[model samples]
Target: MASGSIKKEANGTWMFVVDIKDETGKRKQKRRRGFKSRKEAQAELTKLLNDVNDGTYIEPVKTTLGEYMLTWLDSKHDNMSRLTIDSYRSYIKNHVAPSIGHVALSKLSPLDIQKLVTDLRSKKDHKGRSLSASTIQRIFNIVVTSLNNAKKMQLIKENVAKLIDKPKIKKKKIEVWDVDEIRVFLDGMYDNRHYICFHLALLTGMRQGEILGLSWKNIDYEKKLIHVTQTLSHDRKEINHGAKSHAGVRSISINEKDVAELKRHAHRIEEEKEKAGEELYEDRGLVVCTNIGRPVFADTIGKMFRKYYRKFNVTPIRFHDLRHTHASLLLKQGVHPKIVSERLGHSSVTITLDTYSHLLPNMQEEAASGLGNLIFSDPQKNEL
Candidate 1:
């Protein structure tokens, strides 16, 4: 887009004109929009200049956030999964559209966004359930993102959503089981039939869905590596190959004992497969599966985890916390941040450090040791 001017007529009408390139990469192009006042026309001129400079300018449009989001979703639906499309749709219907759907795209502001989040938390659903902090944050991100695109497209002057104060979420303390506690948990798990699920959880730190959703094809017993290709969702749906973050896509090293146990389980499965008559197994070759060899439901895995907790006589924790335990353990052991980041499938080492900085012992040790030397050394004593 190129710059132009706001022309004022003798009749006291304001006219704004923007010169821009057309569909072809040629110089032949033009645009015309109007306002009731010279101030409005001047503001539009400034917006066009800034947009062209920022490389995010799109022509102004008379669309609402609700209307534009629906259009964007409709256009981009094919690029997303069934679950993701459904989720975005729900976000629009429930959060974005309901609150600020009537607000003009150009007029939405940061304060407005902050108020929306506050109201979401205080508002009660039909079931009397208040929105959680995390859920509100997710919705805020979506709404902001939609407005951000609107700004880039030149539909809005700016993304005031970016300027809004995002809600704060306190990170929960991760509970990691000590060796003795782990032993008790394992022993209690053996009494329950879902011991295999518990074994994979603590031993590998793989997610519940990853374990329940594991297929034989993703397992490389020869290499002793577990390839995480898909995750089992909390809703019992299997989403193929998408992880919570890029860092979540990882292959983990298993212990020899785990390898031996898996071998036994494999043989048992083989026997069952042979006895069940030839090809009942889809040959998809899942490492863990249900009776007919399809992926197990995520709820079933959670139930199994809870059962083992009761049997173990220990503090009950959510299954996802196991992954946190694994990362926390590695951090405590002074493992490099880069390695942990890769193992966890975090996008970068920065994320790993930010998330687990409290658990990291090496930096604390260095800082402590350095401070002691600086404070108590002979040179410092003499100087003081």
Candidate 2:
């Protein structure tokens, strides 16, 4: 029986080979080269035998980490969104491929992964800026997922990243405005051009894209509802893409006051259209658009809000925070979390709860007190 052998190759490297039966009962030889010495070759052979006995031996493939990562990204291109694919491409190019791309996929170890993360954390640019712990963790997670996919494809026998510890990330505190502050801001901009935009965002808790993507057809004047079917892409594309998820496609009831304002805005748009004529009116039919009816850019809206922000002299909060403020105010008033989740187009009530759980303790106490008052108002009921 042919067991194993170690010999010097013509290129001054030691090569080891082991004769074994594969899963199909066919005789095969597992050969590995590139060992610098006979001792290393013998030690590898011994370990190979142990692995074969333990039923964990896998034939290693000669593929570098960079090659596998590129292949992996190509494989996932169709499954991921445009923005997501772009982000993954950037992460791989900037962080992963530059570091451990030379290592063999099967030979990559937990130590190598740990060292890569440490290096990433310690590195600083000329401006003395290092990667944030969260960013480092995100890069590490991408590698972990890529390796996990490789394992699933049987490209590697094990995922080394799974054995490595993830970097710790500090969660930033969520800032929101109270109703009084919101009132001050809205009142300050009562006659401003983008007043309706701020009104819908604070009232409905819709995302910036959703608000910007709204069309006249999406609104139901009779039922007082706004259908959220799609949102604007980050690049300010006009055509609406489907909302983030199925849960994101929802209909939120609009208050009559906001509905009347929307009607007035629509009439104003129509007047502007008649004056400008069909030539000047681009006619994308967006609820919020430019003077000639082209889709409004998100940055433009943000800049407008910032200008009014200084005028209002209220607490400084990003326009996105208006959505959070809406959710927070509703949760404090004891609105059902499911309702809040639906209005905000969150994927689940759990997300809503987790995001606003800071306010839950007070709500819980109020709920308990109300229940006690309802059930224990009578002395006999209290005793029972």
Candidate 3:
């Protein structure tokens, strides 16, 4: 019989209600599942009814992944900056929908997802290499998140995507620059045109985007600090807003050296403006920007780092490692985890400890000391 939650007058057809609970405790009725067995269908219907009574049955609708993703993208109107959403749309269009756009909403299965991921894992792109595990994982996560939201929207009966086994992602060991390494790097940067960018990155744990987004107004050379509040993206596109975390918005301490470098750079900027004989750059008071005074792209900074590596015979690392190096150096110098968290703009102190705990000294001494004190200490209450 055709099956559904509501009754139909035709044979081989039925209507039934399902019960699914929302995030709240309230139970709701969702209708329809097409099963061939009458007894099985009856059980399913009864279970759904019970769930509705118990506040557990999630509704079922028939919207495909493509449909849900489109809605999700629309909902991100304000949460995401304009530039980011543009890239997100591009990625989805070029990499995602082309493969699975035909899959039915209700018929989507883990096997289908697993095969998609596995295939991507093996194939190379324009880079002439198989996609990195991290990239593949990100794409997979976006798809799963979109599909999960679909389930929540009652467009699908079950979130089978959750059941799929995900490939184990390895956390590559972080390569941080030691104090000597930082000194060497900065010494070399003094002669480079992008020295200001490299110097601040080495000193403060601010992200690449944050450093690039920096405005001169954000810096207090007299106070020897730089306030990091935002970041820039690729293409010098506007919409680099808000720090990665609330803590990321904190002021970073600068030294006399950084102040001097910025001073020298500022003078050069005015020289370039005079050469152009017009207000070619934005008057945003940016600390580091393009030659013409637009915001710097994150990838451009990364490429700059690569150029330095080729020039200096240094080990190749992305611009981001500068932030990691800053945190690791702080921890090595016996700075507290909370301070590191604040410096790196981690959302919480726990995040700091988790990331750097392995690099800290062993807890054996503290544990032994605690044991000794507890064993020998007298109880004040007992004495009383």
Candidate 4:
């Protein structure tokens, strides 16, 4: 059974001590002082004894929020992706640490988190722009995840964040180009330097990094297939092997025309490599690169697209919408959504359907119309 005792401290304050056995069957004592009355000490002691009996007791700890968050991040290092780890570190270092690093982990409250969220929402960056709703939400999520882990570890009895409301996120409209718009854009790109990149993006739905990370080795000309095994990191300084989820590492079928275009692009790369000579040739073996054989940066590619878009006077669209454009065009052509999801490397078909649900009504109407025509039409009556 748990037991407690009250004693007068040398500092002339009442102290309470509760002794109990821990989960490991070892006896331990929790002591707290500075109460002015025996009644006050007894009240706290009673709470501790009840907690010990209920198996909900956690030993007092001096761990600060900053300390716990850093340790939590370190524990996640091996399981998380490099990009994710980096992002977490940035948020912790730049935001969480600066704001509430000194707050004791056990002492943190829902109001403290709410205040942090409010401050983050109002906080301006070096550019004098307020924090975006998404950024603030992400920070809140990180803290909540950290606190949740703490709760799971029995460091705290409750996750205060659960009591607060999550910031509302504004849904973004998915933008896509129609077939006619794509045709106009591509037709204006004849003999353009980055034609292969744009063409592969629209036709294959390959991401920018995947397109930039492509190598001759990833393609099988005879099989008319392309493999996505790696991607250029957003920073454009390193190749992230097995970059996305396992689903992202997939092989997509290409048309013969696309394969022919790829071969031409390969040949052009060879000529450029030769022109650069042995000394200047970086020999990275990437399918897309600069004149000097260096890996082409993603920003440079985006800027190139933007420049061409302005010059051609086509509808203004971000380069990423090309992937959306490809999916949209295929859906309009009556292609199955599962196939589109696989080609786009989405983790699930549900994501594909959700993203393109707007287009589904038309397809459903067509299906209904076709079924009605088949069921209601009478060839014999029509002949008569």
TM-score of every prediction relative to native:
0.77, 0.85, 0.78, 0.87
Q: lDDT of each structure?
A: 0.73, 0.85, 0.73, 0.87
Instruction: Encode model 3's per-residue lDDT on 188-283: one tens digit a residue.
Output: 778766788888777887777787788878888888988877787656766366787667778878788778888999888887666765656565
The TM-score leader among the candidates is: 4
Show model 3 residue runs off by greater than 4 Å: 1-60, 165-167, 279-282, 360-384
Query: Per-residue lDDT of 199-268 in model 4, one digit per residue for the tens?
Result: 9999999999899998879999888899999898877788878747778999989998899888888788
Lowest summed lDDT over 10 consecutive residues: which window, candidate 3? 1-10
lDDT value for candidate 3? 0.73
- lDDT per residue for candidate 1 within 133-156, as digits (tens), equals 788888888787777777666677
Q: Candidate 4 at residue 238, lDDT?
A: 83
Alpha carbon lDDT at 74, candidate 4 = 94
Clash count in backbone of candidate 4: 0
Q: What is the Å distance of residue 321 in model 1 from its true position?
A: 1.0
The candidate that wins on lDDT is 4
Cα error of candidate 4 at position 162, Å: 3.7
Ranking 1 against 2 by lDDT, winner: 2
TM-score of 1: 0.77
Query: Runs in model 2 with CA error above 4 Å?
Result: 1-15, 20-28, 33-57, 124-128, 238-240, 371-384
